[model samples]
Target: MKPLHSKTEKALAAFACICLSAVLSFSALAAEKTYRLTLAETWGPNFPIFGDATKNMAAMAEKMSNGRLKIRIDSSNKHKSPFGVFDMVKSGQYDMGHSASYYWKGKVPNTLFFTTMPFGMVASEQYGWFYHGDGMALMEEVYAPHNLLSFPGGNTGVQMGGWFQKEINSVDDLEGLKMRIPGFAGEVLAELGASPTNIAPGELYTALERRTIDALEWVGPGLDLRMGFHKIAPYYYTGWHEPATELQFLVNKRTWERLPEDLQEILRVAMRTAAYDMYIQNAHASAEAWEEMTAEYPDIQVKQFPDDVINALRSANTKLLANYADNDAQAKKILDSQQAYLNKIRRWTSISEEAYLQGQ
Candidate 1:
């Protein structure tokens, strides 16, 4: 028989093997664990670029996590509440949400600033404000109290002014005009004596066709083509409101807290990548759709609002924003941050993008 010391060593080696095997088994189980999240989006099923952003985000997150993270998306059709996404996510009825931040302006007044403002920065400039400037911090301040975290979901670079039944010639033409315009822009239009109403996306075409609304601004050519607004409305005005219409992804704070740090990072990177992809996709789709629209419908009149009308709207927008700033401290903070950033970046935009476009 072996010496007692040798036997003791052998016993220790066996015990060590068992401990190592147990540790390896525990790690394997940990690696196999999965986390699932549910998302509610404001758009309808397969709703093109807007809907695609959510899908892209979910796919990226799942793939990046190597099947450890999975996200299920419910469109408006499934959830049956396009505008209620904010409340659902906030209440923890949904783990996440995809919608426009400005949609919640009535419920949360400070949310109005997160989406595009009238005469606001363009997409690139607004994105810079979001990531490189104080935009994200300001947004968090607005959302943190509500048990929600918001991020830029996607963007429609520069939305069209709207589809109009009649041409707007002067400021007077806006008087008593019933339009489906949402967000702070609606408030601006209200100040200008226009009746602005927010309508759900599914009902917009019917509302406009039925004369329930004299005009409506959906997205640009990218989305407008599918809605066939040109078939009914002869005139399409250029954009003024929503210069960079950014959509939002909202997360329930509780749900976010439950995610591991690695998963949280994955979600963030996925959302950001999806948002950028949607912006590029929209731009390309708009270009292609515009060509198709012009070719198929020669009668479609692409018109710009008169200088006096634009100037009047711009003046009204400024005054209304001032009123909001005066009424609410949070609004003031957000507005101040956006304006300061806009003032700084617009100089570069003018010399770079504006000059380049003019030269082209």
Candidate 2:
């Protein structure tokens, strides 16, 4: 008869083979399903970062899901206006959309907090709050009532204030300044005596060039380059009312739920990665664009708003928050959560980001 040791070795080898078979079987099962999703964007093929992001997101999703999921991106012209994207996603008109949360402030007053706060967190801090703090949950809570799932798409860190037809010498200069501003920031602008009008991206240049609006704030240097604001508007200002302007990817709740588990994970991971790419790209591109703009157009002047102007905007933001809290439960919740998260993270930021910037 065979020894007991020999028999035991055979049994252990058989167990190992069974485990390996189970793993392979599960992998094969996961690889069998396919999901097709749509991602809508405002910028078409020409905008480098936006287009690259959309393409990269699609590629990453497919790769991550092992070809089990594929995303097809449609530009704004393919459907209704880009500004209408949030509503379309909410109404299940599309599976996903890439846009700024602030654009939908009419539908969800609090969503702007996720994109930018008047005098709030910068890009790194915003990302910290989003991934680690309560930012994601707060944003999701605000969008949930509207039948959407929202995630951070990207950020244009600490944007250029905007282009102005004339100098903003003081708070008083803002009075009756017909400008294209959106969301709660527009409310803040209105509080400071400016008349804020909501204008879509496609129409902004003509409006500014025709003197229909006195001022306009788009994303930053890279995006502003595309808009060619430098050509029409001579005065470019800094201390962007909407600092750290974030972009969000909004998806339909029902459509998201229909995705398989692996596909869902793929989408989540791809979006998270895309957010990082966007932040880096925007930051780098803004620097290059600013240098190019100043070099090419010596006639144009770039300036920062007066300290008094910044202070007045801050005060307006405070009042804006109070007004928001009075009428909006979700807005209040988001602000509260954001405030708490900021309080927690500020300690580390003081040492890490703030100190480094100061040293710089």
Candidate 3:
């Protein structure tokens, strides 16, 4: 009886050991599991500054996560939907997206506020709002219901107004002027009797070359140089539309939830770093491209909209913004927040950067 009891105890010990080993193996497997994500970009493959942001982000994320997290990018050429990035990511067709938030304004009015606004803050001031003030919170309020998270992907520090087939001398010149402008700026121009349209980046050069569109505003010389817009349009107007055009990264809520805390933090760091890098890169590239453009295409006339046109645009902008605030309580909140912050920061900016530039 004693020997049989000892044998039974030994069998139970072996079974316990096997159970522990299985649990340990499962845990190890779980620890080593890899998470792969896919990103869709509004820009086509090998696009310059904008496309570089996505690649920089992905490389940083993968390296930071030690290969446990991978991101695959599909540009517009592959997806065939430059403007469909928001929908694709939200619907889980893609895990992430790189596009501008304002592109979705027609679908979500509040989204218009997250991207740069007409006559709004510059890149530094806006970045201050995003990282230090109410910007991120307000953005979340707008996107939460849609099950999306939005981050500042990159900034094209003050964009050129656009390339115009004809110079804008007066408010009358804007009448029936067909231009490729997007976001709130388009609405502002529309209010002033101009026809505003949004065209994909890849299609822009063709549209302009063929005169399907009269004018288009891409980024500054950094990007516009490659598009060969100067060859078609002579009058290159200075910026007012997008003082700080910020591109966005959209993450599906489900995808965000699935990421481990470490990976989530890694993504945030990667995005933030890439965004800053793009801003600097754009500045550098624009400087170089501007030099080359002037030397190569001396006839590319750089013009600023006349005082009357500027006044008219400002008036239209104010009225449209006021109307939006009156119609939507959320719009009111966002506009008011931006205005208040701008009022506060502009004072300091005046003393610092603006003052220094004037002295120089």
Tell me the alpha-carbon RMSD of every candidate.
Answer: 2.9, 5.4, 2.9
TM-score winner between candidates 1 and 2: 1
- Residues 334-356 of candidate 1 have per-residue lDDT tens digits of 89989999999999999998999
Candidate 1 stretches with Cα past 4 Å from truth are: 1-27
- TM-score ranking, best first: 3, 1, 2
For model 1, where is the 10-residue window of minimal lDDT?
1-10
> For each predicted model, how many residue pairs clash, with residues at least 3 apart or on different chains?
0, 0, 0
The window of 10 residues in a row where model 2 has the poorest summed lDDT is 43-52
Query: How far is 260's C-alpha from truth in model 2 (Å)?
Result: 1.8
Count residue pairs with overlapping backbones in model 3.
Answer: 0
lDDT of 3: 0.93
lDDT of 2 by residue, 258-297 (tens): 8877678889999888878988998888889878988999
What TM-score would every model get versus the actual structure? 0.94, 0.88, 0.94
Q: Relative to the true structure, how large is the alpha-carbon lDDT of every model? A: 0.94, 0.83, 0.93
Model 3 ranges with Cα > 4 A deviation: 1-25
